[model samples]
Target: MASSWDNRVAFVVRYLYDIDCNGYLDAHDFHCLALRSCVLEGKGECSKARLQKYQHIMLSLWEEIAQLADFDKDGIVTVDEFKQAVMNCCVGRRYEDFPQAMRAFIESNFRLIDLNNDGILALEEYRYDCVQRIVVEDIKIIDEAYYSLLNDDDRRRGGITLTRYQELFAQFLGDQSDDCPAKHLFGPLEL
Candidate 1:
């Protein structure tokens, strides 16, 4: 059986690496990164300062994710490499205590998912990006219950901050739910 910590770590890693939203880590996500780099490179008519800022951010993120996922040192990460890298990362750390590089990857992906840049993940955003992909009915039920556990104001506001996300995952440590909602975020576990 997957331990509670295992489930949480897997959830966070899934949130970071599953960029194409097809429910698996693969080269397509890398292609998406490359395409973004191209956009930054070709932002000719856009403001130079804005383009430069985005370019630098994209380069940094590309470097970090490529370094982690590209295990064969072949300049690309295969599906196996992606899974191995995620499994190896933050092994000694708890759910919310991801290393700086891992945290950066999470934040980078979170920025992509947050769409409006409002510093929060609205309900629909979270539902579409993370929840809807999960197939198990019981797990979805758990997700709904956990989401309801958020503060009334945050629930009403339509989303939670990144800190609030981490907090909720941590809260799962004490929760006696048969299956964790956080785990469902990544889809069904093998256990």
Candidate 2:
């Protein structure tokens, strides 16, 4: 009974990971490789430092989505596993904390995580989801802060570059944006 339940539960979690996460067999599995490549690969060189920084961003993004994970087999919370943390977060269309198994997510997560039984999760796979999520989230937050003719028109025009995104933050969010740098929205990540 125990082994059967474990298998079933693990299967469902994998299903959910495929939907939201980069669809690795499991989110934890993805992190396992990302940590090694991004952090472990760093050395006493400029590239090494650059890689580590990217790793940090991936970790942060993972942390954000992980708030919705489910760990306990009882469909309840009792531990602090990353899976449990992820299931606890806000994801999906409405950002609602819907309590569903991993198998439930059938949305187009192909661009984010693919569940093709691929054994390894590359840096690109890991970072793309993180960066894209960060961009969308940042845009939402920015739009909430300001909606002037110039501000609203620029984003609509699509002429605004990533470099100018920082200026947008400084202009509207102002001091609230102080704690976070504009570069965080999107920057070249090599790891």
Report, for every candidate in turn, its global Cα lDDT versus the true structure: 0.53, 0.33
- Estimate, for each residue in 80-106, the C-alpha lDDT of model 2 and write its tens digit: 353344333321112223323221221
- Report the Cα lDDT for residue 189, model 2: 15
TM-score of each: 0.52, 0.25
What tens-digit string does per-residue lDDT give for candidate 1 at 1-191? Answer: 65355454444345444566665544555445545534533433446564455445545655676788776677655555654654565443355664454455445545655767788876556655545344455546545644654577677776777776655544443243445444433334433
Which candidate's TM-score is highest?
Answer: 1
lDDT of 2 at 41: 34
TM-score between candidate 1 and the true structure = 0.52
Report how far off residue 160 is in candidate 1 (Å).
Answer: 1.7
Identify the runs in model 1 with alpha carbons over 4 angstroms from their true place: 1-31, 34-51, 92-101, 115-117, 128-158, 166-181, 186-191
